[model samples]
Target: MDRPGLADFLRRRRELLRPTDVGVAEGPRRRTPGLRREEVAMLAGVSTDHYTRLEQSRGSAPSESVVAALARALRCTVDERDHLFHLAGLSPPPRRAARHVSPGLLGVAGRLVDVPVAICSDISEVVWTNTLFSALMGDVGTRPGRASNITWRWFTEPGVRDRAPEEERDRLAAAHVSDLRATYSRRAGDSDVTELVDDLLQRSREFRVLWERHEVAVRRSDHKTFVHPEVGAVELRCEVLLTPEADIKLLAYFPLEGTDAARKLDVLRVIGTQTFATA
Candidate 1:
């Protein structure tokens, strides 16, 4: 790894960002111009000492996951993220998988403090989320590996459907299956697409049946009811906005006009991505 280069890059990027830019509250007594090392560590899911050592140019090479997390925490652009990877002596993530969210998109998501917001990968994996979304629908941090895949969870994990109204469950499952089919078509022969499909087919008889029908459609706009543990039932319309390259999708859940969702979301915003098990 280019230790000095990486250290310089990390420090410079961290220095350029303010607390509010990443949805953090600034302290009245705080005199530091940018985010502290501890705050960056907290945001990047790393230890303060670890981030500190890296910034001091003495740490070992960071794993791919760590680098990616740092890029997101630093709100690096696509090119910047790639440069970071190179400086860390690692290859950048493939655009086909598109796990790295854009800086502009991240900026938008950060400002959406009152609403339930989440960013998903092209393959339906939850890559990032704002606070309210976690409060409403469990935290993205809790969903590791295949658990992070919405379609995989919907099919393989029972009781996940309990969040949605019972009547809409079947249609929702079919809709997600259709969305996966659309992705499968676009990313044909891709290992990321194939493995997820193959695994789901093997694990879920329900998924198998739906995959056979070959449905194709992306869920752009939809109404979903989330039976929140703390907030009760909330009816919201999920609007999907694609990033410029259409590699990632941002899902914003807005309260329906007649629903009590606004108040519920405000409460959830206070709850702030603290997660719990539904079952």
Candidate 2:
């Protein structure tokens, strides 16, 4: 995966970035030229040994913050930061990538039920989720093919109507895809990413066509509505949170203020629990 080359490249890149470029003064007798290992390490707030290990590709993975510090030390651009992360097997910080899910993260998703909560990692893989989220979408998790992914399901599956009737479905689907696209742009070469695109192209003409437009979107604010067969219509506000370390997105769905969506959600929770117990 170019780990060694990437590490070497990063190290050389850092060394090549002179103090002048980073707005630091060039000290006397720079024998090797470029910033000293000590200088780069100091700026990155890491031990010289650690930085050396990273350059040699002989170290454990670095934290996102540490990587960010290193990126700054090397004067990496945004694309470079993301590329560095990809080489290191990390998602870019909560801003541009999807992250793996942990128990604590699942707990947060479970607790925040007034909204649908799902966690996706880089390349739009659905790693973990809460019950209310699955229930609202009407067996989305059980659907064939890419239906397991919100973006995939929305764009590539024919099951949207079962989850939400016409008008509401399109809005939610569009917003979700837009958010997914924003994340995808930073790491376009991930294999799963290519698979998703291929599947969509082959399975859904709409996604195939939209894929051509190359419209990118970030997970900004959006309004979503779902017409649940059991709960009638529900309107929600969407918020996306990027997790530290892994660029995972925590997407939450909140009901519109003072809406009956709250009670509907309660019912969904009960239903979800029952379903889980049975399965």
Number of backbone collisions per candidate: 0, 7
Colliding residue pairs in candidate 2: 97-247, 98-121, 98-122, 98-247, 98-248, 99-248, 115-253
Give the Cα error of residue 180 in candidate 2, in Å.
3.4
Model 2 lDDT, residue 168, Cα: 69
What C-alpha lDDT values do all the predictions have?
Answer: 0.86, 0.66
lDDT of 2 at 270: 75
Best by lDDT: 1
lDDT of 2 at 242: 70
lDDT, candidate 1, 3-35, per-residue tens = 999999999999999998998999888877689
Error of 1 at 249 (Å): 0.4
**Lowest summed lDDT window (length 10), candidate 1:** 135-144
> What's each prediction's TM-score?
0.92, 0.55
Report the lDDT tens digits of candidate 2 across residue range 83-132.
87887778776444342244345456646645677666655555445557
Error of 2 at 74 (Å): 37
Q: After superposition, how far is residue 119 of candidate 1 from its true place, in Å?
A: 0.5
